[model samples]
Target: MSDEFTDFHLEAGHAANGPYALDVDPQRAGWGYSSLRILDLPPGGHHSFATGDSEWIVLPLSGGCTVVAGTGTGTDTDGTFELTGRESVFSGVTDFAYVPRDTQVRIASGAGGRFALTGARCERRLPARYGPASAVPVELRGTGNCSRQVNNFGAAGTFACDRLIAVEVLTPGGNWSSYPPHKHDECRPGQESELEEIYYYEIAAAHGKEGVGYQRVTPSGHGRGTDVLAEVRSGDAVLIPDGWHGPSIATPGHAMYYLNVMAGPGETREWLICDHPDHGWIRDTWPDQPVDPRLPLYEAPAGDAR
Candidate 1:
């Protein structure tokens, strides 16, 4: 692929720091508001981080953890939270903990695990909170081979954040999601909302081999050019600063999962999008077809692996 594709696609090592398999801050990503980082911890491993001016949620990708947060640099602990995580992204939904801005957070887990720090630069300093997996809304969208499951754990309607919106999408093997090629890079009343997005991938391995999938993003021709059609795997990521993104495809036998973190400078926090006119009609056909039977892959109560 050309730079148009490569520019948006980030290989595993291209974005890493310590235990973070993927780290994209507003500055590093050349955008504002949205940012994401996935941390991998070994058994009994502990890592401390500072949430300078960003409000964040510690969502688990695997395993459990204990989070201790404090306001001051010294030892005046402000709050502590326990997160009962899941076995993997393919597992059921997991509980999460939110950390306020300008705070220090220390995370320690009894067993190894991976955590997604979904965040957004914000002016508000809301109180730290916790969200249970049971409370997360799981939605099934599209139909047939286009069917997908969405865990709106940190979505605008699900979680109360100053500006952030995060969600996890699971597309069963051979299915497609993020369909109809939608764009949210323009703020059109009753039409669309402007938002920068980050797509972090985790594809399930097949037959003892590394899994593989595909992602697509085309420029909306609004002066913010971005074009990409990249092959992705576990730990890979795609950035959508401005463009129409969709059709995250899962190959046969290799289910796909992506964590979407989005935010922008909009006055309100919402996820409104406009589908490509050519493919917009796909939405109309969904009503006639049955949803893929392989849905609700796993219930929220898979006996928390943590």
Candidate 2:
């Protein structure tokens, strides 16, 4: 039951517990690295947790909150950060807070909302920090139908963490993202990494209609045998401990969004990956096609911080 690839598919409400709407720890995932937690807070509600051996990022899926973080051994227990979150994950990029390992952090909100806690286990303890929405790099990738907007919020080299690498991706309705199926199940020195990955989805419902999407994961014959084909929706999730995964399809009527959390035991914090040979050639044709115009959805308002 704990096999990462065998227990890869998790429907909404399957992982719920307490204040956490969904919880996927490394042990449950069988990868021993990455994890994800979705917290639902009510008006004036709060939740607290110890970082322990993992570094975590507090990203608001909707609404705003205040974060107070401190280490048990440190004298300064007043480290507070205000995240001016937005209407929804589909509406705009949001501010976030990074909690270092072995520390304690508390989250309090005057208004209720859902938040994503993306994490990774690591031995190194980095400094607790806050990242503004303005600082997040927005990138549009692929071509035409394959086009998708990527928010490299906590991706490696962009944000400093001991082992965590998190990113948000938005795919337009009827489009395909995570294309050219890629695999990182091997540490090939300069080519690939052996990271474990988690995909948490949040599909956008339009015109009172519900949202739906699909995901696929096939075996890579490297670590574990894996095969999955799943219907994903808001609050749904999938784990990829090892395999060639990709081509996450957004249904015709729904725009899809997913938060990716990844981590590995490689010597360096890297995100190298190998694209599936059969589909890798698709990248070469991108130059001939036009980028999707529906991209860059909900750019943050020009302001101090939002």
Candidate 3:
């Protein structure tokens, strides 16, 4: 890969700094809004930080944690939220906590776990709140080999945020997700929205063996025209500045999971994308095909659809 592509793909441990196993901010990513950090805490460990000018979601990758939000002055408190996280990314839908900008937050893990701090630079300081696991909208999308399950926990309209739009996707082994290349690099009113994105991946293991997946991002005639084709593994991440990214393919025996963190300069916090014209027609065929049986690896609470 060329320097541009390599710059966009971060291998496991390559982006680690201090307590974060992985960290990417707007300055580091060459963008203005999106950022992500993975915090790996040992059993009974705790960490604290200020939110700065970004709104953040404390989403667990495994285990559970208690999030306490407060003002740094020691006289005011936002609130405390207990997250009963799952065992792993493939286990089930996990709960998350939202901490607004300009506040101090602390996370404590009793049994230890990997947690994702999905963030976005924003203008408003929303109230701190808890998001229950049962409130997530589990959406089964695509069909057949393109099938995937989406946990829209922080997606726009689901959970309120100023600019952060985050979601988790699970693709069965041998299948693909984020297919039929799409781009949100242009602000076309109702047609599309300009946004920078981050894809954080985790591939499930089998028989004590590791797994892998692929990610591709092509030029979309916007900005610097980001291009990337990466062989990704657990803890790896891909940044999308301006490109038509798609076909995140999982190898035959390994289930793939990815957390998408998106934010941009647009006024509205929405996730509207324009599909690559050549492959846009694929959506039309999904109506006639049967969704893969392995979809929705786990179900959310009944009637809790968002």
lDDT of each: 0.88, 0.89, 0.92
How high is each candidate's TM-score?
0.93, 0.95, 0.95
Root-mean-square deviation of Cα positions for candidate 1 versus the true structure, in angstroms: 3.4
lDDT of 2 by residue, 136-197 (tens): 88999998999999999999899988999999999999999999899999999999988999
User: lDDT score, residue 121, model 1?
Assistant: 97
| RMSD in Å for all candidates | 3.4, 2.0, 3.0
**Candidate 1 lDDT for residue 236:** 93
Off by over 4 Å in 2: 1-6, 71-78, 300-306
CA shift of 273, model 3, Å: 0.6
* lDDT preference between candidates 1 and 2, better one: 2
Highest lDDT among the candidates is held by which one? 3
Number of clashing pairs per prediction, in order: 0, 0, 0
Error of 2 at 11 (Å): 0.2
